[model samples]
Target: MTTFTLEPQDNGRLQSLCGAFDEHLKLIEKEFNLNISRNNFTFTIKSNEENPKSHHEKLIQCAIKLIQDLYMETAPIKGKAKELELQNVHMALQERRMLSQVEPERAKSDVYSSVIKTKRGVIKPRGVNQVQYLHNILTHDISFGIGPAGTGKTFLAVAAAVEALERQEIRRVLLTRPAVEAGEKLGFLPGDLGQKIEPYLRPLYDALFEMLGFERVQKLMERNVIEIAPLAYMRGRTLNDSFIILDESQNTTVEQM
Candidate 1:
């Protein structure tokens, strides 16, 4: 069991952080498989004791830190503590922790200070690795970002693609992913090729939607300025004047690449 208290907790900010009826806490608990109980500003997080240095413990700590950060910013709590926000919190915490373990000089460097412009606003890299990743994307013809889940790999890639398209740097944007199922058989799914494959490509669409807005993304798709498809669809085609993003490339076979 881990216990901590939030400092200078205003009732309104606390309410916003936890959401109405403690929905935010419940969401975090569900995701981390932990029990969270609150008594005013004090919070108790309990998890399986058999495993020391557990991921659940880390997640709980990150959640608490995120709550404190938001409280300090006086950010609106309503609709703020969603799955996406939690995911970002997890990523930020993971990056910060990892960077802290590395060389202090590298951790302090402002390499990722460049901002990526989008229709929504400027997208900045949250950490040193992300900064290097964006710099590579900008300078190199081909770049790869390989990392475990909860990192901003896909999100940053989509942001770069959107930025390029918006600046007229690329005539079109191509997003592709392998239509491979995890354990379930794809043959069991109903619908045509496009519909059946759409589920696999949803993450790309989601990132694009966040940066470009849904209506604008749809309009661009209609005009073929933005193209998304299964990797298999690109077999005989010659792509030109395009900023292409291949997500979930690990799921693709050798021939697909």
Candidate 2:
């Protein structure tokens, strides 16, 4: 166990540092397997093992450094302290290479240990590689899940997106794919943007409907909270605060990419 004090901490800064219900601190603790209790500016980090391994010590130091870095980032902005979001905390840790290098091998023994929670249920990785893939989705801004068909790659990706949306981590979910017709030649289709391209993006829709239910999905689509569009529709607009999925990327040309 060790104690560290963030110097000259202000109350507002502390709130931003800890996040809502100390969620940010909780994330750090989970990542490093440490218990953090705080008194104003002072914090105590307690590990489960009394005498932690050398790598564990290194992780502790890394956690402390990350806390210090995040604290530094909480400095007042134009006379007001900026609120630090979960994504901000994640970005800070990723910048330090903490998430990538610190996840231990033994963490994967339970395939369901690191799971994505959705309203429907928990999504578990089927194998070691899938476990790493889920972790990548967690710790990276964008991830590509490449695998053979029926390997849960597409389903898991959609599950993660649904979980993110349900958690309010993102404002919207936008799914897109190339619309190269395989066998059918439909001369004309009359409908909204999403309806026109529904066939091409049906797989993505199926996953969303399963997670969010049919009526809710329809309501979200009406509100533009969930969008289904062809890849060509993405050219002129910027997507922010949204989980965007580009499915069937193999069919895209260099220009489309």
Candidate 3:
């Protein structure tokens, strides 16, 4: 068992960090499969003793750090604990741990200080994986980012695409994703083919919107400089001088790929 107490002991901040009914702590516990007992500002985290230096231990440590970081922020956490938020925390923990374990030579090679320039400002890699991902996209004919959700795989890809487009390295940007619904039928949804697939492609749209702004994105779409479509529509089409991004690629079938 590893135990520690947050400093100053502010009840309201502690409550905000833990959430209603300690839901946030429960989420961390469930994710790491550990027991977390809390008394005031003190927390005790316990896990199996077989592996003293397990990933779970690291997760707990990272979770504690995240909690402290959030508590110190000016804004307080509100509402119910969200799964996406927890997943992002977990992803950050994984990235931090991965970077710590990277060999010195590999770290030197993988580290990137270059930032991707966009209309929104500059986009930089948050971790070694992102640095390598961007490097691969810039160097290779085709690059893929495979990871769980909230890992910024799709977001970074879109950023790289946007940067490439801004630099005239690619004349156009093509964004596509498999039209797979999560326990939802496509026919049941309203609108035409494009409308039906809009939800699936919304993430890509959001990234583009953030990078290039709404008006510019709309104009680009009108001119076909930025094209968004379903993966099914990509058949029999040859792409050249285009930055293509396929999001939610795990849902894609073998034929779609």
lDDT winner among the candidates?
Answer: 2
lDDT on C-alpha atoms for all candidate structures: 0.74, 0.76, 0.74
Q: Candidate 1 lDDT, tens digit per residue, 11-83?
A: 7667756766777677666656678899999998888456756576776775666555544443333324222
Clashes of each: 0, 0, 0
Q: Output the lDDT of residue 251, model 1.
A: 84
Off by over 4 Å in 1: 1-110
TM-score of each: 0.59, 0.54, 0.60
Q: How many angstroms is residue 132 displaced in model 2 relative to the true structure, after the best TM-score fit?
A: 1.8
Better structure of 2 and 3 per TM-score: 3
lDDT of 3 by residue, 1-257 (tens): 77888876666667666766777678667756778898888888887456666667766776676566544431322332222244444554555556667785775463543457665654667778787888888789888788877888988899989998988998999999777865568998799878899887888999989888899999999999999998888899989899888887878888877
Clashing pairs in 3: none
Question: Which of the two, 1 or 2, has more lDDT?
Answer: 2
For candidate 3, the lDDT comes to: 0.74
